[model samples]
Target: MLDRLDKEFAFGREALDVRAYRQELLSSNIANADTPGYKARDVEFSSALAGALKQNGTASNSSTLKMAQPVSLSTSSSLAVTSQGHMSGTSTLAASGGSTDDYGKLAYRVPSQPSLDGNTVDLDAERVQFADNALHFEAGMTVLSSQIKSMLSAITSNS
Candidate 1:
């Protein structure tokens, strides 16, 4: 019975998680619209949801939805910086202040209209996406609520 409940809620739960994360990304893009050289980032929603669901199904403790793990270079054959001007391969990741898990899944958005300052965020598009994702998140929550209500009613009626 517990397993049955888990299976029933898994899809909606995973979807909501993805939608919530996407909302955060869109909000960040909107917030950074004025920052020069700021590239807007987003996930491919359908694919991300699919991957999350797949991982959830295979792993027993897969309650959390996560992106792909970031790749790292082995120290054995890593690049050497002989000159002081050289930057390490991992420096960009560190400078971005984002974990490899997050950076791996996020893709830069191409600007519809190029900005003079090189920021890729389009406010109009970000707003549209944010609204759409919020709607989907609400829908998922409503469906989950309905499911739980129905289960509760069934359990009470039997008692």
Candidate 2:
């Protein structure tokens, strides 16, 4: 029953998480606009959400027991560790600063107008992205809330 609930909401859950993470990235870019060579960073939302869905097994093979199980990246053999002492990819990203370890796929934003300080962050672009992402995040929250409310109403009616 719990797994069913998880699988049902996994997509929306992951979508919200990615949106929030993107918000952070955009905010960071805007905040560091004056920093030299900061290089604006932002995540590709569709790709990130798709990857998360695959990890959650919600995008494919939903009937399998693996659905809703978190994938262990440490066990992935494709990852090449330069040194035994080196931290995992997620931890490394978190340690570097802003972005979380989840969906460690931030892309550098291309600047429309080059800056003398070498900073790629465009204030106008960042502001627009931030607002758009925030709106999406709020919409996701509302949808999730509505789904839960509907479920509760159904359960209560049956009781």
Best lDDT among the predictions, by candidate number? 2
lDDT of 2 by residue, 1-159 (tens): 877777667677778778877887898999999999899999999988877667656688565223323323343234457998976553222222112445657899889999998999999999999999999999999999999999889888955
lDDT of 2 at 56: 53
* lDDT for predicted candidate 1 compared with the true structure: 0.74
- What would the TM-scores of all predictions be? 0.70, 0.75
**Mind sharing the TM-score for model 2?**
0.75
The total number of steric clashes, by the backbone 3 Å criterion, in model 2 comes to 0
Clashes of each: 0, 0
- What lDDT does candidate 1 reach at residue 75? 38
Per-residue error for 43 in candidate 1, Å, reads 0.9
